[model samples]
Target chain A: MSDEPVRRQVTLANPNGLHLSPISALVKEAMNHEAELLISFDGNIANAKSTMELMLLGATCGAVLSVEATGVDAEVAAEAAVRLLSEP
Target chain B: MQVRSGIPVSPGVVVGPTLVLGSENFRIPRKFVSRDVVESEMVRFHNALDKVCQDIEDHEILVGEQLGSQYAAIFSAHLQMARDPRMVGQVEDAIRNQSNSPEYAVSRTLRKFAEQMQNLGNQYLAERALDIFDLEKRLLRELLGESREELSNLTEPVVILAHDLTPGETAMLNTDYVLGFATEVGGHTSHTAILAGALEIPAVVGLGRCLAGVSGGETVILDGDHGQVVIDPDEATMERFRTSQARNIRVSERLATLETLESETLDGQRVQIFGNIEFPQEVEQCVKRGADGVGLYRTEFLYLGGNKEPTESDHYEAYKQVLSTCGDRPVVIRTLDIGADKVPARIRDRFAESQNPMLGLRSIRLSLQSTPLFKVQLRAILRAAVHGNVRIMFPLVSSLLEFRQAKMILMDVMEDLEDENIEFARDIPIGMMVEVPSAVMLIEEFAREVDFFSIGTNDLIQYTLACDRSDPSVANLYRSGDPSILRMIQAVLKAGEQYGKPVTVCGQMSSDPRFVPLLLGLGLRQISATPHSIPRLKEVVRNISIPEAERIATHACSLDLARDVEHYLLGELGRLCPDLVV
Candidate 1:
């Protein structure tokens, strides 16, 4: 099995930023796959499945975030997170 | 010492140490926990979380049932935030790693998150910080084994100072130890103000941020008669307030002696002073205040305070209790008068959306549209009438046709009762509330059809002035003392006299002491008002002669400006009763 990670860059499109609702939504989406998800914003990396870590990132509207995943379904999980984050 | 003024809801003067309650920003005590007790601390944290979640859920259901699902969504958001696994994990981590007390950990963690949210610079998201802060306080309070002090536990009499109070909180206040209350927010017509009036507690609301400066145990004087709050007054100010308070007590005691006396003017003219009540329990208050009868028994409250539409038995039980309480004294029950902002969501959703509900389908209009609902209330009134002297009145009857239609419904209900051989009041006196301008124009025609007329000045003035009373932007124009409104009332009274049909003023105007003389001068011999105002109204009634009132009424009717009319009435009331507080 390959150990290399799948990664993508997504810009926050929600006018409200990564507030409780959007962060919770992201966490719920991240937990759906077997991939280990990590989101990095402004030099701070947070576990994509942790609401507290994502909220602490304070990734507001228009901020670009790096989503990295490493597992069998890493491609699927990373793609889904990027799409959800970029959707207005 | 400083003084601030607000809207006076109930009339009286009180001086006591302030009891500042319901501060949303409660201080959380922080402490360090030993390594051995870390597990216990986590348990305590989870227990507090569980309790808060339960409370939020219960409150959500209550708000959902009482208001509707729309308003109940607010509590749901709180519950979601509280139950967030990430937030819970963060708090527990703080407790174990930092060795912080569960209360401290929760407070610090939530505060940090809230601060970050506030810094996000989005107004809507920033406001969410308040929810987080509220949850933090609730959790901390629960973990610390502290519950919010119940207003019922107050030992010494105090003047309660608060930012604001919900209707439920206001209702649960123990009036025995509550000398008065002053709030930072609320208008004259707010539910807290209404509850204060019902409980006969002097209250000054809408004092703004000035109450924030007041601390618990600090001496403050609340003068609800003038809507003034004096914080930590000097000796001279204190002395003056004490004298004023003593005078108020003496005046009330003296007025209480007039309970048994007939409400009569100096020239031997008789006036009927009746009590306006919302609940059956207020009947005892009406009797205590020496009301001749129940002037206005608002039946709409039966529809409210419940989730679904009230059944016929619900109506029958409420009406029966009120009738039995009033005994033989005539109880005038006004039919369901719901509309505007007050309509229950269940019934409200059934009707077409109204742009302006106050002027739209409301009161008799809504009742007529929902015939089955209307008939249930009518049947209940009829059934209750068998217990005592009960009269039915239809509110907001604009035209003779509407009046006749409502009467026809009542007649049909009576016929059904007769067929069933159910005992009912065969000859119950039915009346129409003269509120709309159209009703005023058709008063003479209405007089011929209805047994009597009751002037509901609250809506009449609002409609006549083309102003919504609740709209602060136009509130200045919604004066009951407007010359146009006065003329309209005089017209109704003249028609009543012409047709020999009795007319009563059963609005806020009847309860206002300033308008008592003017109402009497307008030849309104019957007044139904809040029970607490009856004694003062009777005092004003006994002080003036019919000739004097007629003179004031003539002059007031001629004035074109509402301000001029109000000035003239105030001056006349002051002259007639020099010692009376207007």
Candidate 2:
């Protein structure tokens, strides 16, 4: 169980912006891994597990967000969140 | 604890637990929990969240089944937002650290987030604040154990206390469980008021923020007769209301018995009691109340609500529905009378603005000027006339020229229909509303041209007194009991008699029980009012003799002051029917 955090930056690709559907998808994907995941958008940090926290970030289309995770699944979770955010 | 008065739109008395329906901007009270009870407050918060989530999920599934997946997906978003961990954590933090109650914590946290979203200045993001507010209200309602939706799942009969009920909400009400309703907003002509009257429930509207003082399950005394609501009444007030309620029930029972009887005076002179309805659905109520026919079916409602102009077929369908429902009963359909403050922006923008719209282009004037619009309505009326006994009435005909011009348009439509070989009633009785003082002064000329005359006392009184009824500052001066208005009514009745044409009073005055004897005495053989008041009006009509009513009318006309006329009529009404409560 590594305490070191894995970090990745990804740009939101959805044309309609990060509304409830995209936020729900990201939260569901992050919850699949056993890691403490955090997403920061425009200097505002939010827990990736919280749909409302992701929504509060108000990350619009093409906005960049940094995904970070700390635990055994840190690498996988960070990669998954980044991939989901970068997906069409 | 306090008494509030408003305009009574429907008449009855009821006492029951108040069911306060949640509305937009409905506020939840903030309270603090003890420090030791912080954990319990957090538990309550989660429990409420779980309940709201389950409710949303159930609704989503129901919508998915009934509608398609695309429509149902909207509720899925709501569900995800409900279970959002960060929002739940924020609420829980408030409950634990600040010792805030679960409802207050949830409300405060959601409001903060919603404000943040709204302040983002993006239109899409700002709109999301509405979703947060909706969730907050739903959660708070679940925590408070009140139903989140209006007029749904009411287990017991109760008086509904609301800020206001939209026409759609008022339409879906289960009248069996909704004993009565009171709102903080609306007037006598609002959709809520008209619906309440049609449903035959006790309702008082325009209480103005008194609803905020009331909570669910509190006992309330709603006097729909006097338009009063007493919250948490004391022993004395409760006893008086109880007596009044019992007496009202007895009086209603007696009135119900008169529904099957003829509206005749003691001398056996029969009178025609008709109903004035705004919607085609009200035709059933008119028939149920045993109205001889519909004296005034205001068709302006066809133009009011919808986004687009009503097609000729739309008007035809409405008229057909009323005519079919009435069976052999005569249904007098009044043409579109939209103008003044009643004109919507869609129609108003098409015309030049009038500074004094009340005296400007409206009713028959607007109809004549807009030939295409008038012809479409005339064609619809003529087409619907084939279904049953349909009568056409033109409104606000100030002069004989306007009446003749309007009649000419009707003739043109009739010729067009004949050319098309569309079957229609050739001799459908045409009438004119004697509303303007000019029309009243020239009643003999109007009587000669029209098939019948229906005195529209509402506008006649307003025009006669030069007091706008909608203007609250001078509404009290818009009295039907004013001798000048009564004399105008008298003059119309004499014209109808001389021409051997039927004369009807289709106005608020005819519905008022206090004014019924005076109207009967003035020799108005036909009277039309809201369907709810028909039975009560019939009860008054059946009890009085024409000679006695005539004597009262003569004396009332002799009285100089409006107050004196009202006082004398009220006294006579009491003497005529001691048990009747007006």
Candidate 3:
């Protein structure tokens, strides 16, 4: 298991932007991972698994966000975060 | 009777008993707990969260059954928030360390999240703050052992009035019991407004502090047609509402007959009535309303809402949607025309902030500056042209040189597509929006180069008078019926005549029934307007002969004052279509 966190950059693709539906779905996906995940966007950082915090990021459609995860499953968590956020 | 005005997002008339939802913020009872009770308070907080989650799940099922799964997604969001681990941790921590009551901790934690969301500076994200507050309210109700006044439980017919509605609450509003709704605070773009429209529930929003004066069970008249809500109306207003309701039904019944008919004059001259739409979804409405085709599909929506600059495929998909819907009908796809300030921050960061964004690097200027971005849209439009009749129209092209530059990029994109052997429609007729004064003045030069001309009367009126369109003080001067606007359209029309190309008035001027006569009188054979205005324009179009329209135009053009020009045209329209029900 790696001590250092893995990171991936993802941009929001939903036309309605980071409204509740996407935030809720993203939070649910992030919670699925065993790794500790964090999402950073426009100087705002939030626990990726926290629906409230992720929503607080206020990422609109096309916002480039940095996703970080740490644990043995950090790489897998980062991949999942990227896939969820970047899908059009 | 108190007359309240708001931005109408849905269309209907309803008179019903008002069900005003007062503030959900109840008294917390107490703020703190004894240190010895902290462990018990944490347990109570978790229990309330569990109960709130159950309430949310119940709503998910009810909303899913009533309003479809798309709207039910709101509850799913709420459910996730209720079960949020960090949020739960925060509430539990407040109880364990701070010795706060479960109710106090829940209120404090959720309010902090809600306030943070509201101040996020993004409109969509800000609206989601209501969902947090909704969750807080639900949890509070559970913790307090209080009954909730859920709209899904309504039995009698009533109009739901509220301070503000969460998307989840708005979604579950049973149309069977909920005749219509209004709110003290909400914009036309708010989820309440959007859901109201989706539910076909007549709604008025952003009525300010008017709700505090009225009580529940008061007789309310919500006229979404006029964006008005009348409480305790006078006899005259009541009579008028009854007549207006009858008139609304009559007007639609009258307009419904013209759906399949061509917009032809009494003299048998065919005028093309096209739809000007922002979204691809609106294309169906335009088609359903018998628009000859899409005259102006504003492509800025693709760039404006999203964080990323739309890919070629993004543009291609949007164009394909519009073109596929239009089928063989000519669909003139207007390329990106929004200003930089309106785009996402990433794009906005690229442009130097200007005092006046309207006159700044926007439309063709922004496109020319970023040929890569411009080429992506052009390539997509060309590729989508293969789907159906597609014409690429450049917006706000102020100069022949600017128009040439845009054309060169389009030509370049075409060459690239050809080199790559990507299938694309080559014979796409390229046009420029004849909005800018310089473009109108150089119509003769532009006529020699471009395929068609669309007189963007909104910008033309604004630019011709140098009156900011958004400025209320100058709004009176920003008339589409201005003599200068008519003269410019005439010049463009004359040029179109010489060039043997179609010149359409695709601005707000074309959609207006009063100006329809003047525009037709000025020899515009095509009118592209929003779908809602199509049937009325078509009624006016079919009623008058080209000779009559020409006479009206000549009289209107002769008038010095815009008011006189508009008044004369309105009078003529009334005479032409005496039964102008639409």
Candidate 4:
């Protein structure tokens, strides 16, 4: 329910960082929330909903990513992104 | 006289002369040839391979036209591999180098190629040896009479002895003339055993190298029950076997007759007898053996065997066949019970390695996480439920949270289907297998949530005692008749009683006639086992009174020790039916 853009920094812990399946799961959850979500790693940002784009980011394990969402569900989007990154 | 023993795949004893169909021994070429002559030989070899491929194509067409497309496709695939350009090139080079014949050339070349491929370190290509060798051998056999060595013409019902038989050869076997089969080098789950089971032929596989010396035309008796193949029996031994064979036949026939017979005790106590199957082929066998319904249909075989995920239609067709075959009989399909051991390395590559896969992310864990694959199976099952009686069950659920989470997903899938107006079974009884010790301990909670419970005794016994049944050294530790396991079963049954839901035992113990009396004594009304074991179990059930079983149950429960429980049950079994033991 936040109008302002919410940003959260999280480190990828999965040995295989945001592999296709987990990335897909995160993308699916992001789509569920009414938020314009973007994930940035090493100055590279990608649409959280685009599987192909997220894969192209090449974010390996132990890399830090700052995820930002701006919309009615920005809080929910940031919460989901933080939660997904913490899982193996 | 020689006797060989192996696990009996099917029931029936065969008394006949042996027939050995040995592979033609290949000899290395010793002669030298000029380059021109070698080149000519290579051309001739390639032509011979072409002819063989053509023959297989023709045979495949005929087979596809006669039998189903599936059988024809197997032959077609073999033909394609035989014509592989790489293999053709290899054979040609070998022949050009003065290989004795096309057979010798292909065998030698393929062996070298396979070793090279293995050394290249590509697992996928390396495993193609069987595929390549099998195809080339079939072609070589067409070129020379030696390839037909495995197929022998028999006029009498003689026990066919062999080292191994391919599925095609086994399928081509004259069932009427072939009484039984014994092999030296096939596993219990080998293609030969599966084909034999499909054909309802009594077979013993994995007999090792001893069966080679079993001469053709020597009088031999195959004891499928004990996996024993007896030769040159004395008059008394022959008489005893004849009696045993007749009894086995009668017992099977009697069980079949009881297909329409009620699963009721002499005291008029009603019971349920179900069958456990892993494939759709076993559904018809269940009907033939008089199974009231399917207790646990392992759906893993659907997802297994293919590289990619099985389409919804694949799952639907398979589930539909099973449901339609069962008709009104309730079929409880257990969602994929696959573990790290069964899954291919590629699919397993995605998962984090666990120290113990048996207790790791398997069964419910795998399905819950793999939504794409799980949804496909769920949708298929739900869609197939339109045909007949079908229910869903989850496996390896150690906690109520897992069970509830699975049920929620099922509900969501059903709701989506309802929104789409897809015809599916509503009010399908959902259940969980109480195999894990934790689940068994907390059965009361599971019983309240699920409509039914089926105890998978195989896992319960193994996990409870920390023993791997397959390891012969620790097989003693995997006793199902152990008091601890019995206590677990008793707990499950009591929980089911408290919740007023039907509980059944659907593991190996259910089929063992030795343990039947003990289980029956434990107040279990529903029993699901392998279809073949139905009649023996039914006979045991029909003979015992509820009071007698209850008394045995009391004595069994009083057993503080494990082996003592087995002893007590074995004694009871010996007294009740001495013949079943041997």
Candidates in order, interface RMSD in Å = 3.8, 1.6, 1.2, 15.7
Scoring only the A-chain of each prediction against the true A-chain gives TM-scores of 0.94, 0.94, 0.92, 0.93
Cα lDDT tens digits for candidate 2, B502-559: 9999877888888989988988889999898898788888889999999999899999
Stretches of candidate 1 off by over 4 Å are A1-88, B1-4, B15-146, B150-173, B177-193, B205-221, B229-238, B345-348, B351-355
lDDT of 3 by residue, B1-582 (tens): 789977676767999877767585244455577999887777888888888788889989999999999998878887888888888998888888888788768876876777777777887776777777678778878887854345666768888778787655676678898899888876554445655754667888777756544535557899876679998788898898899789877887988889999889999999889988876888888889988999988776676444577888888888898888888999998887756324445587767768777789887888889888888888898888999998889999988888888888888888999999999998989998988999989899999999999988767887898976434344456677778777888999999999898899876567668888888877888889868778888999888898888888888889998888877877887788765522
- lDDT computed for candidate 4: 0.73
TM-score of chain B of each: 0.76, 0.77, 0.68, 0.69
- Give the least accurate 10-residue stretch of model 3 chain B, judged by summed lDDT: B468-477
lDDT (Cα, tens digit) per residue for candidate 1, span B1-582: 879877787778888877766465343333477999999888888888999999999999999999998778777657767876678888889889989778667866776677676766667666777777688778867875654445766777888888787655676778889898988777665556766877888898877656433335557889888889988888999999878777877888998998989899999999999998877888899998889999899876676655778888898998888888888999999999887645766676865787877778888998899899899999989998899999899999988889989999999999999999998888988998999999999888898888889999878887888876445455567687888888888899999999999999987777888888888888899999889999989999999899988888888888989899888888887887755753
Alpha-carbon RMSD of each model: 10.7, 12.5, 19.0, 23.5
TM-score of 3: 0.60
Clashing pairs in 2: B1-B231
Model 3, global lDDT: 0.80
Report the candidate with higher DockQ, 1 versus 3.
3
Of 1 and 4, which scores higher on lDDT? 1
Chain B of candidate 1 achieves a TM-score of: 0.76
* Model 4, span B437-551: residue lDDT tens: 9998888888889999999886788789987643435554667778888899999989888889999998767877778777777889999987777877877777788888888
Q: Report the C-alpha displacement of residue B448, candidate 1, in angstroms.
A: 2.0
Clashes of each: 1, 1, 4, 2
DockQ of each: 0.15, 0.36, 0.51, 0.01
Model 4 interface CAPRI class = incorrect
In DockQ, how does model 4 score against the reference complex?
0.01
